[model samples]
Target: MTDFNRDALGPPAGLVATMRLLLVEDNARLAALVSDGLEQQGFAIDRYESIDGAEHAQTIAQYDLLLVDLGLPDGDGLDLIRAMRRRGNSTPILVLTARGGLDDRVAGLDAGADDYLVKPFQIPELAARCRALLRRPGNALDSVLTAGNIVLVTAERTIRVNGQAIEATPREVALLELLLRRSGHVVAKPALENALYSMEAEVTPNALEAIVSRLRKRLAAAASNVQIKTVHGVGYALFAPPAADE
Candidate 1:
């Protein structure tokens, strides 16, 4: 059995946002432990115990990562991994299972798993591995994101304006990262909601508005050249306003 009495691990360095992860594992205790552990490291986990449930969930929501176990109550997890790859899904997959044999590891990798971790592993190592995968070129968690005078370092989870650091809550930072990534493009409301909240969070109707308002105030106080524009009944966009001389 995996140890459940260990201390909670610290958040990994360079975590960009509250990445959403889908975890497929049958053992109830282990699933809960894994979910709790990853959530503490600044991830939002949506868990399922079977292949059918996992497949259904994916159709409804986009996930940043997939954590799958080889042995499941319904079928082998390898089949699920193989099917996803065949369908052209490139979301990073990390295998978590009791199968520690060399052959099992090779099979998992060949089936398109980016990484494999045997059962009874420490949460800290698992968190570290996830960050490593996200750090790869072209992945979502880029090292740094910039918009006009505002700079955000994903690895350090710090925001700066004109090289001076500014205080921001985690939610504010997450919103800023999303805006900076698609700067000048209108990001739909639903998309922003998904990036900012997890499946289990009880978000009120005006929660998104409230977050946007606070972030706007913070940016203005920092004297950032970039601005967030509400598209009025549609969505929001971030862009630098034209200079007065222009």
Candidate 2:
């Protein structure tokens, strides 16, 4: 049994922003390689080497896709799949395993995997599968968040202005995504800090402000239509694009 929510399709023709994915693989080397490859294609990944960590992550965060390996130290990946399905989690799951036999594939699908890929797969093939999975109706985050000519593809961690690519660091990209996601609304500074940095990060005072300042400069230099408007004591917001006449 195999499930295909969307047709077998390759990545989109042109460059587009991507979405987030949760990868549950116990092999450290493989996970690092896969994460790096996927990130190059614009996806943000949160990886877990054990089933327990992944299960805990599921309780707090939502992801566009799940890239899971079959075997884990704590338990079989099949159990996690079954639990997620039982809990009514419809997030698209793509199983990556060395188990290439027909029976293994059948069991994975029967247990509720959305797609399956045997190990020793190419990065291109994996990327294609990811694109296809996200293309399914309601299976992905908004592909593009735009404020006029400035577009933020949160999934791809890409920023573009009038169709021109503007280079962005990972932190800047993450910050841009947060602002763009709530473009018209205010995002508190504390929330932005949390979104940009993990709890354990040793942050200095005004560090967030410095990051925002740099980001603003980048946006301006690129002639982007969107602006990051700071509210002094309050948080920041992605201001609506200027009117044509203005």
The runs of at least 3 residues in candidate 1 whose Cα sits more than 4 Å from the true structure, single-residue gaps closed, are: 1-16, 136-246
Top model by TM-score, which number?
1
Q: For model 1, state the Cα shift of residue 62 in Å.
A: 0.2
- Which candidate wins on lDDT? 1
Over the stretch 1-246, how does candidate 1's per-residue lDDT look in tens digits?
222211234335555455778889989888998889887777778889889878987898888889999898889999999999999999999999999997999999999999999989989788768866665434344668877888899878799998999998877788888787677788898988987776446778988899999989988998888989999998889996654522
Q: Give candidates' CA RMSD values in order.
A: 15.5, 15.5
Q: State the displacement of the C-alpha of residue 23, model 1, in Å, after optimal TM-score superposition.
A: 0.3
TM-score of 1: 0.52
- Model 2 earns a TM-score of 0.50
lDDT per residue (tens digit) for residues 5-117 in model 2: 21123333444444778999888889888977887676777788788888887787778899999898899999999999999999999999999996998999999998999
**TM-score for all predictions?**
0.52, 0.50
Task: Please give the distance, in angstroms, between residue 101's alpha carbon in candidate 2 and its true position after superposition.
Answer: 1.3
